[model samples]
Target: MTATQDSVSSLQTSVPPALSLGVVALSVADLGRSLDYYRQVIGLEVLEQDTHRVVLGAGGEPLLDLHGQPGAATSVAAHTGLYHLAILLPGRADLGRFAAHLIREQLPVQGASDHHVSEAIYLEDPDGHGIEVYADRSPESWAWQGGQVKMDTRAADIGSIVASAGQDTAWRGVPAGTVMGHVHLKVADLAASRAFYEELLGLDVVADFSAHGALFVSQGGYHHHFGLNVWQSRGGQPAQVGEARLLSASVFLPEAELAALRARLLEAGHPLPATGDTFTVTDPSGNLLRFGRKV
Candidate 1:
């Protein structure tokens, strides 16, 4: 709650142990096509695969384990599923290389914008799930005021951003230790999303703008890691099982703090829908947020 040189990082009074992030999975409509796109265009190395799924990694660590199935490809305008899976590049030259790669592979970006704290290239995956290719500006450079995280989006000069992606090399896949930086959501309602992620889940509200139908928050200030947008889904519900399902998600926390949060949420009448070494609560929007000891 206090800020020194590093203000955006939310130092919780009773933080649970640090269970840093784990891998994220996407259930794409066509496993082969999705895998091909990620592996070839995005430059991720495939770890393992069979008839049903494929696991992938960048720098040798798994980032996503994709489940392939035959399902209806819904309209991006109406799908109540993933907002985007953000892939954090090590630097900007890598981002440029990625931009080059996107251009090479004929990958179409929905839009690319610079959010003062970072620059991002946005695209939709094979099954309508959103994807963001981005890299952050240093933490020391992030700005804050009035109990809100400040962010602005403008045209990121494609040439400048690509030049920064990697000073020497092109950003094909993330460097080793790449993680699911953060998961953004396109929920139906902002207030409900805020209540569940902030109030019920106890995440500090880093930023909330009523006009934008958007919010930006993170445990540590890493430039608005998790994003929520409701432009199309003004009041949509979570997607059903047949079309798609969110296999799982996580909240990296210190192991020391799990029991306390679990007890706190239980006392608040929002006990875990499922619990183990970790506790999980489904948001009003049906996305699962996992809290557990930091791995």
Candidate 2:
């Protein structure tokens, strides 16, 4: 059974309810190369670009911003950073189109699988950040029991998933309520992970399974916003360069609330990084984090 629990008395939703998360930025070894891979190869439009960063989008808004930081190195087993940035697609058809595109372009896929709850396509961004591009199977269809969300990893009918995307003449972006959704991480200790993301981050727990080596939590009512798994770090300490380095994770808050959080972080000694008008910060595990008004 899940161990994490939602501590919020009630979820405070903002006006219009900010879409899950608009953009997740990552620090990469080669900004130019990654930009080319995402834009030219991945086919995402370039919304904005600068010497230090580049934002790419599927349609209306930017989904990912790639930042070039020379010294940002990551080791595969690093338990201190981002787990994965999930991109919720418009539908199965969109997934189809992307699959076809990957086949046509010779794009490399790390792995693809059906998580019972959702079908996911995964790949690593140039800087070693985990990226999951997926489509949901309608909320009403999701299976759950005993307050535990049932998720499974099984073979995906790629042919069927791809067929959906190939249906429409053009790709419709991610669904209306889609988001960066949940971020999963490898934490040193279950208790400490709970202390920060739940008590401190203030997100409600949706699932907590100490037995399954995972924990899931969310804000408002849209599944989990973050997940923590101790399978890799069941008894390890916070070390450096574990294969994966969570470049940065984002949380969207109202503009005013974001300002408040900035002050809160400073007061807590987790100073936000100032870049032009953006203020970013690093979490206890050295993972970079960004916050801004919900977009």
Candidate 3:
């Protein structure tokens, strides 16, 4: 059954309204190359680094963890894995500065879209892992109809966004408050994914784009925290180990909410081995999601 916001509220269990995304982990082919791309192009600062692993973020908060596996195969379109890791800038001005920086860098942007709720710019990392840097419109500006947010793809007003940068046009790095907003994944089946994320994980379906083979879910009344689509990955296989792809995405929840989710998973027959403060689960489509208590 397709889950709607009303139906989600009626569920016996639901993800805490305060739930939020945390750092996303990825496997990259070349540590050095990926680091350069993320730092120079994506504007993330290196927080910690070692030979095979690196942690990066903005404003001292961890946002991404890259694990290097030398000679790893690059991700393929047929693999059911990351579609994009979205970075949420704190404000539209930040996005404007970023947009101007990309222009100055002459980086090739794949696409730019105004989604009504937000404006997004899309690109790829050194390993072809997709990336989206965006700023959301104010919550009050968002439109809701029939328990679903009204969103569409339209050309973004780059000129207006650049103007929003105002006098502080210099591109320093992503400022404080930047975060890993959401993670979009390519899955083999939309229904199975919905069942896993909505039913088992308890995230509410905020939007259903079944006609486009996509679904979006979130906690609270936010537009979406996770986007699942089969646009190119229908009937696809999971990424093989040692391939450059998403390793996992983390979410933070209140302690009680985390415990409730754990119990629900256990009751539903999803194996969740005991972990200290955090636990990881593989969704039906093989996506790894880690849950931890929100501090």
Candidate 4:
């Protein structure tokens, strides 16, 4: 096989073309603290907020919803729950601006990596929720082999990325094109998580890092729309109801695809609890997913 064909050979490269990830809802113990962190540190503007709930976004898009739970405890480590929510900037320069802002503000960064397809910086919220800010390289340059997209974790060139921020680079806030790109979750088992997201939800396993106990799935040949990892929560129970953690992740689909997904869930014996025009279901590891049409 030629070099390009060889790279594509081992990939499970089929994904439904009509799905897009939407807002992720989180439950937090102190709404005010979490709200401030996202606004000042993460550079999101508040779109809507009330005593109990706050919606934050950039350029009029809603990316996160925070619900206030006055006395809720922190999410336990031994739980099938969130690993992180990745915020995708439109370009590498935007990532540089954000990184420079973080450094100037003296915010703590957990780590960073060059995932081959993208560069990402990691941090934790006041509630211990993981957050990843990243920018994708051109798809033409992505590497693929062994039935999966190539991914590796190495120290990101932080100095170089930060240096990209010139006076022209403004850190007003998340730019208009910023988006909640993908979500990573801790799952009890990789096999079951793969079946749930791939067979049931129709995502393609673009990358599988079994050696690292993680898998990435996506649609339309993007690097990943969701990441499932067993690093921290292997063999863990799902978060209990009323826990201060991830609540539900929303996905928008065309009407036809929405109906087709409903049928698949029914055939799999999973309940589709509907409310108005939206329906929700719990995944194999108990994370809630909400699906609706893009009307």
Best by lDDT: 3
Look at candidate 4 and give me any clashing residue pairs: 10-147, 11-147
User: Tell me, what's the RMSD of every candidate?
Assistant: 3.0, 5.3, 3.4, 2.2
Write down the lDDT of every candidate, Cα atoms only: 0.69, 0.65, 0.89, 0.86
If scored against the real structure, what TM-score would every candidate get? Answer: 0.87, 0.76, 0.95, 0.93
**Candidate 4 residue 163 C-alpha distance from true site, Å:** 2.6
Query: What digit string (tens of lDDT, one per residue) describes model 4 on residues 1-295?
Result: 6554565554554444667788999999899999989999999999998999999999999999999998777788789989999999998888899988888878999998998889999999988889999998887677776546777889999888877766655688899998889999999999999999998888888887867899998876677899999998889998766678999999888887788888888899987665345899888888999888876
- Select the stronger candidate by TM-score from 1 and 3: 3
1-295 in candidate 3: lDDT tens per residue? 2344454345333777778899999999899999999999989999999999999999999999999988888898888999999999999999999999999889988999999999999999878899999999987777676667778999999999999999887889888999889999999999999989988788877889988999998878788999999998999999989789899999999999899889898898878876566899888778899899999
Model 3 CA lDDT for position 112 = 94
Clashes of 3: 0
Whose TM-score is greatest here? 3
Candidate 3 lDDT for residue 177: 96
